[model samples]
Target: MSYQTTETIQRLWDDFLRESLAEVPPEQRQQFAQQFEDRFSELLQNAANGGGDGFLDLVGFGDKGPVEFENLPYPYVQPDFDDSVVPSQLHAAAELYYIYQHERMKIFKVVDVLLKLFRLGKMRIQRGPGARALYLVEKWKPLRYGVRDRMIAYRRAFNYGSSKAPAGAVTNVNFHRQLVGLIVAVAQYFRDLQVSEVIRGGPMINQRPFGSSATVQRLGIDLRYALDRSTYGNIFALTMEVGHYLNSILKLLDAPDIKKAFDANTKWNVIEVVSNRYLGGTAEPSQRAKMAESGRRILKFVADNNFETSIDPHLFQTELRPIGPHAEAWLAAYRTTPEGQRFPGVPTALRSTRNRKSIPV
Candidate 1:
C-alpha cells in the first residue's frame, strides 16, 4: 500500500503536468515535444536507462574519481577540484554556470528522488566498480565524488584521470567511482525505505522508467530540480524543464522576435556557444552529424532562446510546494516536491549576498 504522503505527492506531480499541458499551445504540443523526447531518450541511453552510461558511470565502487579525458584540454585549474569554470560572458550562458554552482548541492537532493523512483520502477540499484562513498563535509570534494560526466568507464580504478593534477582539477583520473558512489547513495535511501518497490501495474523501469501521470500522482514524486529556489521553483527547473521554460519566456518576452532571432542564427548563435559550454543542451558535434532535420531545427530554436527575463518563479507561480507531511512527493517527483523550499519568512527577491540575511540565524 502506498503511503498517504506518496499519494498526495503523485497527484500534485500529475496535476502540474496536466496544467502545463493545458497551458501549452496545441501546435507546440505534438511536434515541438518530439525533440524533447529524443533528447530525453538520449539522456536515458547515455546514463539512466537500464544500466546506461548516466547511471553506470557514477558507481565509484572500487576507486572513485573523475574520468580522465585523453584529447580534452586543460584538466586542472582551481582547488578542491572546482571543475566549474567561469564563462567568459555573463548573459544567459554565464548565468547557467552560476545556477549550476549554486544548485550543485540541490542536484544531489533531486538525484536522490530519482533513485527512489527507479526503485519504485523495480529497477535494481546499478552498482559501479567499487564501494565508495560520495560526500562533502569539511572541504570540497572533487566532482567525481558526487558528479558524473555523460558516460561509463573502463578507465582507471577509483580515479578517472591522472592523480598528478596541477594544484587543481579532480586530482587526475578515477572520478567515475565518485559519480557511481552518488548513484549508490541515492539508491540506498529508497532501498531502506521499502516504499520504492514496484507495485502491481506500477511503472516499470524497462517499459516506463519515468513514472507516468498516474504513477507520479500515486507516489507524489515531483520531477522538478531548481538551482536557485529563491529565484525559481520546483516547477519547470531541470535542464530539460529549462528548455521548455526558456521557450515560454521567449514567447512572453518577444514571441515574434523568436522566429527572427532564430532565422538569423540558423547557422549559429551565441546561445549555441554558451549552452554547449554550460547547459549541455542541443546535440554534440557527433549527434549533429546524424541528427534528423526536425532534430536540427529543434536544437536551433532551443539554442536561440535563453529565457533571459522572468527567470523568477514568482513571476510565473509558486510551482514549488511547502515541504512537510506530503513530502513523499519529493522523493518520487523531482521538482514537484518542497524539499528545497527557500526557508519561509524571507523576501523572495533576496540576491545571493543579501539572501544570506534572510536565512534565520
Candidate 2:
C-alpha cells in the first residue's frame, strides 16, 4: 500500500488552510497561514525523525523516514459480535466501556508526567497563560473507582440489572463523546508546549566564537531532556491507539441492531442509554464544567501563544531529574498489556491458501 509522505500531508494541510481561512481578510489570512505552516512543517520534520506529534506520526500516517510502518504486526481485532448471544446495545456499551478505560489510562499517564514536573519545581511559570494552564493541570484529578467495583457494575449491566448497580458505577449517555473531547483537549495542551519548544529552536545552546579558544563552554539546556525520550514516545503511541479504539466503538455503535435496541430516534441516543445504564456512575456535572473551563483557558493560551506572542521557554525548564518509578511502571504496563489483543475471528495458519491449492508443475 502507498504510504503518505510529509510532502503529501503538507500539501493537504496547505489546501485545507487556504479554504478554511478564505473568509478572513488578506493580511490576517497570511499571518494565520504562516503560523500553521511553521508549526506543521516542524511537526512533519519531527515525525520524519521518529519523534511524532503524539497522534499523526505513530500510526503510519506520518512522513516517510527511517522508521518504516510496513513491517508492523497485523492489526488486532475485537471479538465478533453476536446479537443473539449478547444484546447489541450491551455489546456496544461494553466496547465503549473498554475504550473509556484506555482513555482514562492515557489521561493518567499525562497527569503523572505533569505532577512529577510540578514536584521537581523545574517548570518556571510564575504567571501567564502557561502558569494558569499548569495550575489547572495540577488541580485536575479525575476520580478513579476501584476496578473490582467497576467490574461488578459491568456484570450487573450485562445481566440486565444495571439499575441495581452501585452509585457512581454507570457512565452518562455522553460518555464517549465527552471523554474523547477531554482527551483531545489535554493532548492539544501538551502539543502546544511541544510546538513551542520547536518554534524556539530545539535545545537551547550557547555557542562560542570560532577563534575564542575557551577551555570550557557553557551548554544550552533542553527542557525535554529531563524526561526520557522513550517515555514521551510511549505516551504518543498510546494516545494514537486511543483514537483507533474510539473509531472502533463508533463503528460498533452504528450497527443496525445496536441502533434499533434503543427507543430513541438516533444511534447517539442508543449510546447514551446503553452507557448510562450499563457503564456505572452518574455523570459529575461540576467536574465536567471545571474541566471544560480549564480546557478553554489553556486552549486560549495556546491560540494566543501560537498566533499572537510566544510563551517563554524558560518557564518549562527544570533541573534534570528522572521521572518517578510509578510513571515508568505505568508506561511499561501499557506497553505489555494484552487486553486488546483478541482477534475478531479464527485465523488461517498461512498467509495464502492459494499456494497450498496449486498443483505441482
Candidate 3:
C-alpha cells in the first residue's frame, strides 16, 4: 500500500521539483509534472513502510537528524569496534558506579545540613540555646571529623585497591572491577554513617529549629560562609571530582548496540557534528569552544584516576546488619516451622552450615 505524504513534506518536494524542472518546455511540462508526482509519492510510501531503507542509500542521505546529504563522494557506512575490544561485565560495573555517585551526593547533603546548623546557631547568638550550640560546633570540629571519618571508611572498604593495583595489561573488565571497588567503598561508607545515632544528632553541628523567612535568610548567608571554609570546600570539590571521573569512564567504556549508519572513512558528518554541538541547545562559537575544553579536562581527570590504588577489596566482602527483635523472632519461627511451611516460596531443600545440616533460619 502507498503511504500518503504530509502536507509539509509534499510542499517541500513540490518546491524542489519546480526548481529542478524550471527549464522544461511548456508542452513537456505536463508530462514532467506527472512523472515527478508519481516518483515523490512512491518515495514517501517507501519511507513510511520501511524508513525508506533502499531509497535512503540510493539518494546518498544519512538521517542522523532532520539534516540531509546529497550526492556524496562515497556511501555512508557505520563504524565497528576493532577486534581488540572484548565483552566485559559492564552492567555490574555501571551499577556500582551509580551507587558511588549516589553516596557522594549523600555525603554532600550531610555536609550541607551540618553547615545550615552553623548558620542558624550564628543567627541565634543572642539566645542562650543558640550560643551554646554555636560554641559546641566551634570547639568540637564535628564537621571535620564527620567528613574525614566517612572518607576514611570509604577508602578502607576497597582494601584490595588500597594496597596496590595488580601489575599487568589493563582491560575494560579490569577497569570495571576497580571502579566497582571504589564505589563500593563509598556506598558502604554512607550506609554505615546513616545508621549512626551520634552523627545524625548534631550532624551539621547540631539540629536547629526550622524558622521563619527572616531566620532562614540569615542561615543561608551562614551556609555560604561555612562552605567557604577549607574542610567543607574540600569535600564539595572531591564530590565534583568523583562525579566527573564516573562520567568520563562511562563514556569511554561505551559499547553501543545499535550503531549509526555513517561512513567510517568520512572525517566530518555535518548532521552528527551539528547535533552534538546543539546537544544542550544552540550556542555561540565561544560557548562551543568552552564545552570542548571542559570535555578534555574531564577526560584527563578520568585518565589520571581510573583504576588507581586506594581501597582494600576485603573490606567489601563482609557487611554488618542489625538483627533486632523482629528479625530474631522471625528467624526463630522459621527454624521451628517445617521447611515447606516456613515461607511461601522458599525452597524445601536446605544448604547446611558447619554446625547444622539445615537451611539458615
Candidate 4:
C-alpha cells in the first residue's frame, strides 16, 4: 500500500521522533514512539480527508507566524454570485448559511481578538459604529466572569492558588464564549425570521433586533428554510455590515490608552507575574525551580497556540507581540473625514507566516 504525506507533516514526524527520544527513557523509547506515530497518523488522515494542508493544523503550527492585524475572510465574495450574476434566493441563502457555519471559527477569532485588544486598552468603544463592539463586549462580560470561575476551579484542581493559575489559563474560556456567542447570534437571527413569518406574513428583513443567545440551539432547525433571494441578500448584507462595524471600531482605538494599559507597572503580564509567583516565591528552592520550569513550558504552549503571546518577559523574550504595531497603524489610519474612512480589505483566506517577532518588555 502507498501513503501520502506533505513536507510539513514529515518535518513534524521527524521533530516528534527526536523530542520523544530525549524525553523517553532508552528502554521505553520504542513503545512510546509507536504509540505517538499511531495517534499522529490518525490525525494526519483526518486532516487529509478534510482538504487540510497537513497535520500542522492539528497543532498550532498553522497559525504560528508574524503578527499582523487580524482580518476575517469575507465569505460572500462568491464567484457564482458576483455583481453581474444573480443566484436564486434560496440558493444564496443556503450558501450563505453554509459559509457562515464553515467560517464560524473565524467569527470566534474576531470576537477573541476584539476582547484581547479591548482588555489591553488598545481599542476603545466609539459612539456610532461602536455599538456592535459595545454589544459584543457587554455580552462577553458575564462569560468572562464565568471563565474566571472556571480558572479558579482549575487552580484548586492543581492545588494552586487563584493568583498562581497557570499562564494562559483563561484561553479556553475565551474560546468557549466566542463560539457560543457566534452560535447564539445566528440562532437569534433565524428565530426573528420565523417570528416575522406569522405576524407580518413574510421574512424579517432587518437583523438589528436578533443578537442574543436565547434561540441559539434552534439554529440547526432554522438552516432548513427555503428563503427568497431578497432574504438571503439581506442576511449576506447584514454579515458584511457587522464585519464593517467591527473593522471600524478596531480602527478607531485609542493608542495612548493601549500604551498606558501595557505599562510594566500596571499591566501584570502572564509570563512575568506567573514566573515571579513560582520562581521568586517563598517555596523551597527545588519547588521554585520546578515551578519556574512549568511557567516556561506554559509560556511556550501559549505562544505556539497564538494566544496571548504578546508580552515577552525576561525569561522568555521573543518578537511575538503583534498587537502594538498593528494597533498603532490602525490608530494612525482612523479619520474623522468621510473620504479617509476607507476600510481595509478583508483577507480572502487565513494568513500564514514564516516567522514571528517577539517584543521585549
Candidate 5:
C-alpha cells in the first residue's frame, strides 16, 4: 500500500532502518535470527498483498538504490467517521489509541489495553472519515510482540534504550509498564529541554462519568523521531506480520532453547479464544449482524465445490489452524443457529446447502 507519509519522511524512514539494523549488534540478532527470517517472510507476503510499487522497491530482499517514495498507488483515503455520533464496537479501540498516543504506552502496554477492551467488547478500528487510518486491535498477539522486538533490531535502533526500551527481549507486562514510563520520560526530557512540544487529542464520546479522550504526546530530542505516523505505521505493520506468524513463532518457541524470549515470570499461555475485540469484531454491541452476514458469505465460498481451490476441512486444518479452535466452533454453531439462515446477505438458493455454518478463522 502506498504510505501516506511525505516523501521526505519516507527517505528518513529508509535511513532510520539502516541505522537501526546497524545498532542491533551481532550478538542480539543471533538470538532472534530465525524469527527474524520467518517474520521477514511473513512481511514479504503482506507487502505483496497490501502494498504498492513503492513498498516493493524499498523493502524487497535486495533492492539497493535511491529510495522511491512517490508515484506509488496510494492507499485510498477514507473519511474519519463521526465516531461520536455513530453506534460503534470501537469505543475500546479509540480508548487504546488515545492512551498510546497521549499516555505514551509502549507497544506491549497498548496490546494489554486492547485485551481489556476485548473483554469489554468495544469498537473495532474506526475507519475514521475516509479510511484515513485504520485502528483495529487485530495487532495485539504474541506474534505482534515478536514483531515489535524485531522492529527494534531494524527500524528504531536509537529509539530503543533512549527512545523506547532495551532491545532483544520478549514483550511482557513488566516490560510494557517500564516502556510506557520510559517513553513518557523521554517525552518529558525533550519538552523540558525545549526541543519540542508535547502532542495531544480526543474526549472519548461514550465517556462513562470517569472515562475521557483528552490526551497528549511528544516525540523526543528530534522532532523527526517522535512516535508519530512513520514510527507507528512501520511498527504497526510489523505487529500484523507478527500476529500472522503466530504459528511459526509458537513452533519456534516449542524448543526449550527458543522459549527464552518469554521472561522468567511470564504467564500468558497462548490460548485459542475467539475474541471479537481482537478480530476487530465484537459479539456484544458490535455490528455482529453484519459480521454474521459476512461470515455466511465466507462459509458459502468455502463450501462451494466450484472454487479454484475448495476451502475444505483440510484448508481450515492447515491455513487457519492457529485460530481454528474457535473458528471451527463458530461456523458449526452459526450453521445451526436459529437465525443463521436468516442473515441478510446469504443467497437464498445456496442457503439450504450452507444452512450449516462452519467457518475457519
Candidate 6:
C-alpha cells in the first residue's frame, strides 16, 4: 500500500473538510467552512512539517500523556535447553549477542508498522487510556548500544584478562525484563484498539463508522491487511524465543562459577566484565557490524515471508548469504565445545526456521 505523503495528506484533509462542511446550513456554511478550513489547514501543515505531535495531539492521538504499563501475564512457555551447556560461556555470549541484536532490530520494524497504521488512518486513538498506551509505544526507543559498546560488554563478561576495555560500557541487568515490558505495552495497545472499536470486521474499505460516529470518516482501509495473522504469529514466536534465550543467559550470568571467574558482584558487573574480555579486539569490529546487518536482514525476511507461508530457500539464501557464514562460524565454535558435540544443530535463536503455531492476542 502507498504511504500517505504530504501531498496526499493535504488532499485527504481537503476531502474530509468538504464532506464534513456539506451538512452546514447554507446561510452559515460559508463562515463555518472558513473557520474549520483554517484550523484543519494549520494542523495538516504542522503534520507535513514534521510537527506531527501537534497534529496528532489535536486529533487526540498525541504522545504527551501518562501511560500505565499493563501487568499482563506472559503465556508462552520457555523452551527446554540442556543444563550441560550452561557452563559454556562462549555459547552464553553467542545467545546474548544474538538476542540483543534481535531486540534492537525488532523495535524499528514495530515502529514502522505503527507509523503506517496511524498515517493511513487505519488505527484511530482518541483521548483515553488507549491513547496513553500507544503514546508509550511511539516514544519507546531501543537502548543506544553501539558496536564498541556491545563488544566491550562481551569482552568484560567472557574474556577474563582484558584491562584496556573501553570505559562507559555499562550493562543493564534488567534488559530482558524491560524488553518484555515493551512487548506487553505493544500488546496492550493492540487490545485497546480492538476495545475502542477502531478496528472491526468488514471489507477493508466500508461505510461503517469506526470508533465513534462523531469522528470523521477516514479514507483508509481496515488495518487487518497490514497487521495480519501472520504478522502477529511471527511476533509471538520471536518474543517467546527471546524470553527463553534471556532466561538462559541470565542463569549463566548468575552462576557462581561465572561470577567467580570475573570477580563480579552483580549481574551488570558480570556482563561488563565478560563483554570486555571477549570483545576487546580489532577483528571484533567487523564481525559485530556483520552480525547487526545480518540481524536486520533476518528480521525483514521473517516479516516479509511469514511462518504460515512456505519460504523459498534460494531466495532466502540470496537475501541472507552473509548470515550463513556467521551462523556457520558460531556453530563451528560451538561444536568444539563438548555440549555442542552432544546436542548438534544451530541454537534456537540462530535458526532460520519458523513455527506455524499462533499465540493468543
The lDDT values for all models are: 0.28, 0.35, 0.33, 0.34, 0.33, 0.38
Q: Write the per-residue lDDT of candidate 4 for residues 245-292, one digit (tens) a residue.
A: 434433423223332433433212322332343334221222223323
For candidate 1, the 10 contiguous residues with the lowest summed lDDT are 221-230
TM-scores of all candidate predictions against the true structure: 0.17, 0.22, 0.16, 0.18, 0.17, 0.20
Q: In model 6, which regions exceed 4 Å deviation?
A: 1-235, 281-361
Error of 6 at 10 (Å): 30
The TM-score that candidate 3 achieves is: 0.16
Winning model by lDDT: 6
Query: Global CA lDDT of candidate 4, please?
Result: 0.34
lDDT by residue (235-330, candidate 2, tens digit) is 223324443534544443454543443454554554445445544422322233333333333222221221111212222221111111222222
How well does model 2 score by local distance difference test?
0.35
Model 5 agreement with the true structure over 23-98: per-residue lDDT tens digits:
7875454334444445544544554455444445656432544455553434433323211121121221122222
Q: In candidate 2, which residue ranges exceed 4 Å CA deviation?
A: 1-231, 281-361
Q: How accurate is candidate 1 locally (lDDT)?
A: 0.28
186: Cα error in model 1, Å: 1.1
Clashing pairs in 2: 168-281, 169-280, 169-281, 170-279, 170-280, 170-281, 173-272
Model 4 lDDT at residue 291: 27
Winner by TM-score: 2
Q: Candidate 6, TM-score vs. the true structure?
A: 0.20
Which should have the higher TM-score, number 2 or number 4? 2
Q: Name the weakest run of 10 consecutive residues (lDDT summed) in model 5.
A: 212-221
Worst 10 residues of 2 by lDDT: 215-224
- Backbone clash pairs in model 5 (N, Cα, C under 3 Å; residues 3+ apart or in different chains), count: 29
Residue 196, candidate 5: how far off, in angstroms? 37
